[model samples]
Target: MHSDVIKISDKDIKKPKGKVFVVYFSSISNNTHRFMDKLDVSDARIPYELNQELIVDKEYVLITPTYAGGGGDTKGAVPAQVIKFLNNENNRHLCRGVIASGNTNFGDTFAIAGPIISKKLNVPLLYQFELLGTQNDVESIRKILEDFWGEK
Candidate 1:
């Protein structure tokens, strides 16, 4: 079996002032986790358990997988863990933007969580990708974050 691993160079990782970080919630499928692994940046994962505490004190971007299914209603699109994490007043205030992952097969509901959270939090929906995402997605996200944070 051939194993493929992406090695990130130190120079590729931007060390922005004030340390804008990435926070994500991945379900059992772990597709969002796989996507986050491709980016070279500081990140925290929202635990599956609602009782777990995760308080991000600094500005950060949130990456989440959309879970909505059928009829394009967007009900239950955002994971409970993500909702719990964002419900924290501090966390909600510190969030700078959001990136969402979803299967396009869901039509209008694809990546719905991004827009929903963006509106609720008054943050921008930075990006959206399907499933694990491609290399281009990773590069675009890198540039987006660098520009958003005004890399020093």
Candidate 2:
């Protein structure tokens, strides 16, 4: 099936209104949280210790970090908190896309969570970046979100 999720590229230069709603899960290291802070979009952070399920009322992009097991195993790559958040049917339905973060040192598993979630949820993997991302990553993602949501 054709997907509406926008794929970001270098050519997308629209100005972002910072209106896109982002939902993310950041581990204790806060790599994902730190990355989200750099972007101007509205966001909610999924607590590492989730006591209640989160339900997103509107469409959003999910940003999460990879947590691959030892020995370069892909298992447990997607954070448990992220899995819990996505367990809700409403939240799953509203997930427009995903952006994953990881360390390049992990090699083959770098940002693997993005692809896994994208396939499971049938949404696009909008982007992936190393820990905290760069200034270019922030600017590009903001612009892409604006263009995708037609808030440019």
What C-alpha lDDT do the candidate models reach, one value each?
A: 0.81, 0.78
User: Which ranges in model 1 have alpha carbons more than 4 Å from their true place?
Assistant: 1-17
Q: Among all windows of ten consecutive residues in candidate 2, which has the lowest summed lDDT?
A: 1-10
- How well does candidate 2 score on lDDT at residue 106? 80
Give the poorly placed runs of model 2, Cα more than 4 Å off: 1-18, 69-72
Candidate 2, 93: how far from true, in Å? 0.5
Model number with the top TM-score: 1
- Give the candidate number with the greatest lDDT: 1
Residue-level error in angstroms, candidate 2, position 66: 0.6
Predicted candidate 1 versus true structure: per-residue lDDT over 20-128, tens digit per residue: 5899999888888888889878899999888897998788899999898846578899899999998899998888788988888888888888888877776767788
TM-score of 1: 0.86
